[model samples]
Target chain A: MTGWVAVAGLGPGDAALITPEVTAALADATDVVGYIPYVARVAPRPGLRLHASDNRVEIDRARHALALAAAGGRVVVVSSGDPGVFAMASALFEALEGVPAPHDLDIRILPGITAMLAAAARAGAPLGHDFCAINLSDNLKPWVLIETRLRAAVRADFAMAFYNPRSASRPEGFARVLDLLRADCGPDRLITFARAVTTPEERIITLPLSEARPDMADMRTVVLVGNSATRRVGRWVYTPRSA
Target chain B: MTGWVAVAGLGPGDAALITPEVTAALADATDVVGYIPYVARVAPRPGLRLHASDNRVEIDRARHALALAAAGGRVVVVSSGDPGVFAMASALFEALEGVPAPHDLDIRILPGITAMLAAAARAGAPLGHDFCAINLSDNLKPWVLIETRLRAAVRADFAMAFYNPRSASRPEGFARVLDLLRADCGPDRLITFARAVTTPEERIITLPLSEARPDMADMRTVVLVGNSATRRVGRWVYTPRSA
Candidate 1:
């Protein structure tokens, strides 16, 4: 059997949000590998093996998928959102750097609806204008870099989306971010906290920066900070096209 | 009949990239309205009507959809990519702002794969770090604002994706942008030009900033500029997770 690997995105939470391209990849796979939560999203079926690992073991999971593919297995490395965006696609390429494998591996990266876009859709287009998406987890990069990006984004007046905003191990990072944002964006700027977007447990709140508390966001929440011209129309918050 | 409106994304170009949520919305819609190209993507049905208009008439299209929904017609406003990202979702809210209609209309914003992410996945993940998406068109926003944001984004070391890079009306804009980016980010930086992404005629090219010409990007293309740490890994171009 000719072996191949596909790094596919499952989209954010909802099955309906998943594209047919990813659905087809999942259907064609002999083995699916990803984080525990992401792997559980694939349906249980005969002749297909599911290998789910923990969060911090992304490199190991990428290697496992690559190894299985090299051994004549049709593998799909699943990511919760678009694999290219702070997800498995980059890690897969990173894995390739260490392996002295042939250049011609049949690998494909399928895109999906990311958390920030889903969150933007649920909350009325706070990312309607120019925007930046920043992963708030400091495990990969330094906190100083995060602060610099945040301040620069605010100064540029672009809307911002944040993923992995807070974790149990480093809950204080989001607090410092909030403090920094408050100072940079001032009190009246709008901020949106969307938890579990597109799922049954989804909760969305839009408030001014002055009233934003760090506790409003968690691991499951994606936060959106509006640009200077973003505002409320009726009940929805949106950034105007002219901005 | 009870009416509802859904601003849905059709993904970049391929029908396989469209989400089930958007497909369902199109099936349930009695009237589908959008730009000529986007409206043409929707299949015609027995009772369904398609309203394809010229570009730059987003507000008029938004008003038409709102009026149809107010008169109990199920309307789906189609945007080529994600509806909320430089697309129709914000225009709908802008229309709502002008009219004092009932606060709660059954309006929904469905997300899809934006061109940048689709292009990013097709090429490797140049957006593995924090990134910004800016529309290069100066029609909506000032050129000065674009220049300021470009400088800020580069200084922040964020990977950047540019939409609507060049148009017939202002073909010189992208050349200026290239000049500015080269000055700020330097010529050794990597840039990817992905045109007609996910379509049959798709073409993606990656080269150093020194070689990127103005004509390389047109209205159909999405341009990605990698961060300082972004480099070529084998045949793929990816930004490392650590950066």
Candidate 2:
């Protein structure tokens, strides 16, 4: 069999949300590689090898997949949400940069439903207008850069979705974010915290920016902040299609 | 039977890209309403009704779906990509604003693989970092607003994905966009034009901002402009996760 690499997205924690394209990639893989939880999502098969690794080791995992594929293994790297969105696809390409003969390999990136969109769907159409998706984690980039993007998004009057809002290691960042949002957007703007979206533990809450707390968001949560014109129609919150 | 309305996304343009959750909604729907081409994608069945309308009639289409669902008909309003992203979900809520008793009806927004994400996967992960999604069409908003968002996005150094980039009625808007991008992003910045993504007629081209022309994109294209760190490895283009 010809060896190749397929970077596939498992979507945001729902089997029904996984696209047929990604499902096919997983089924055809000789080896599956990813973070431990993502690798656990794939079922054990007769001929498939699963390589589960820890977090913050994206480059290492990516290099392992590339090396395996180069040695004639059909490899699939799994990412929880869309792989291209702050996930393994970019890391795979970054690893490919050091490959001796990268041009000879075949690779494909399969898209899936991302967490922000899934959270938006559950909380009505808060992102129906122009939007910005920012990763709030400061592990890879500076916190000042995050502040810059947040202020720019607010100035642009765009709806915003934040990924990796808070983690156990960094609980203070989200508090700072809430403070910034309350100061800039005022108290009336709508904000939704959707945790473990589409899963059994799913919980979604919409409140004013002033009432939002830092503890509402964790690593599994996606936070959506509406634009100036967003409002509630009956029980659902949505941004108008028009400005 | 109880009535309901589901604003569902058909994805960019592939059967495999449509999630099973959306498929289940369509299977249960008694009526399907959407723009001409999207409605045509659904197969006619014995008990199903398809309502195909023309462009620029979003509010009317939304009201019709709402009325049908209110009267005990299961309705599915379809959109090309994710329904909540410049699509039918927001329009449905806007129409619900004028309903006599909107809370009595059941409504759900089913997400899908959006065009930008699909296109990003196709051309590697050019949107792997922070990004802004802007609708270039000035039909609902003013040109000045679009320009402001463009400038803010540039200042933030966020990658950008543009929807509805150009149309026959307003080709000059995209020309202005190209000029603005050329000035702000400089000559070496990368831009990818992905037209008819995931479809048989799909065409993708990546080039420097200096070489990009307005004619390269149309209504069917989703234009992606990479951040300063975006680069090519072999034949693939990707934006690194770190800023």
lDDT string for model 1 (A60-90, tens) is: 8888988999999999999988999889998
**Residue B127's lDDT in candidate 1:** 92
Residue B210, model 1: lDDT of: 96
Per-residue accuracy of model 1 over B85-166 as CA lDDT, tens digit each? 8999999999888887547688899998999999998888999879999999999888999999999999999999999999
Residues A1-243, model 2: lDDT tens digits: 579999999999999999999889888899999999999999999999999999999999999999899889999999998999989999999999999887899999999899999999999999999999999999999999999999999999999999999999999999999999999999999999999999999999999998999999999999999999999988899999886
List of clashing residue pairs for candidate 2: none
The candidate maximizing DockQ is: 2
Badly placed stretches (over 4 Å) of model 2 are none
Query: What's the residue-level lDDT of B176 in candidate 1?
Result: 94
For residue A155, give model 2's deviation from the true position in Å.
Answer: 0.7
